[model samples]
Target: MLPPRLNDGGRTDLDLATLRRATFGLKLGAGVTLISLAIVEKLANPEMARAMLEQEPLLNLLAPFGVSADAFAVVAGSVELLLGLLVISGALPQVVAILTAVPFTATLALFGATEFLGHLPLYGVLLSFLVLGSLEETSHSLSGLRRRAGVPTH
Candidate 1:
């Protein structure tokens, strides 16, 4: 059974546009926080960042191909940074969200139930963004970064 708050107050006069805008803002905040933490972990603590990749299953798989732990950390950090910018700007949000969830999902498999439980809310946010699709207005995102960059909003 869904929570009572999940319903639209059982009202027919709900403003869906406002609801969507609010959700988008929420997603933006969540994405920014997640990315900021990742950048901090990557930039502030190189040893710990490399150690995390070393502990993941991906390292075992990629090690055979000569991908070192440090290399993996650098690559992962770069991808996260790029995806973080796209997500914050609301550019290709669905794609960005899916990409964002890949590492979280991997962590679930690598670390088991505890990690899964911890990241469940983040996974939910990513899934929500995927289902909600892209935002209609790009101007409100990143102070019109897309427009300023000559990127097509559509």
Candidate 2:
């Protein structure tokens, strides 16, 4: 039989199902990487945590809040790992993924920003950007401003 035709009647840039599935894989893989780093940097190293705070005058300014480096690292790192898993694995819906990316994205922006704003280290920020871009790119694959309506095209 002849191959199927490419209908020009408002077709998508790519197949919706294909995009969704691929996005899920991306979300999961990147999430795992991020979680792993968060654990190592935040959970395992108190000195590193202190260094993070000390590195940023803005962050240090907040020290009056009486937050210990270890405590801050534990909470921040654990949350990043947890959210990363959820986003990458699609354990949560697209909505949750979007919400999760907000913090993740900001984290990346902070890292990227520090290079100029604070002119501090670059490695940490670079890693954060990698994870952030992966996670964001995965879910942001959602197409169309509005949902298409047709015969339940699944």
Which candidate should be chosen as best, given TM-score against the real structure? 1
User: Mind giving the per-residue lDDT tens digits that candidate 2 earns over 70-112?
Assistant: 6677777777778765655454344554555555455544577
Candidate 2: list runs displaced more than 4 Å. 1-17, 60-64, 105-154
RMSD of candidate 2 to the truth, in angstroms, is 9.4
In candidate 1, which residue ranges exceed 4 Å CA deviation? 1-17, 54-61, 134-154
CA RMSD per model (angstroms): 6.1, 9.4
Clashes of 2: 2
lDDT, residue 145, candidate 1 = 32
Clashing pairs in 2: 27-88, 28-88
- Quote the lDDT for 13 in model 2: 58
lDDT of each: 0.65, 0.54
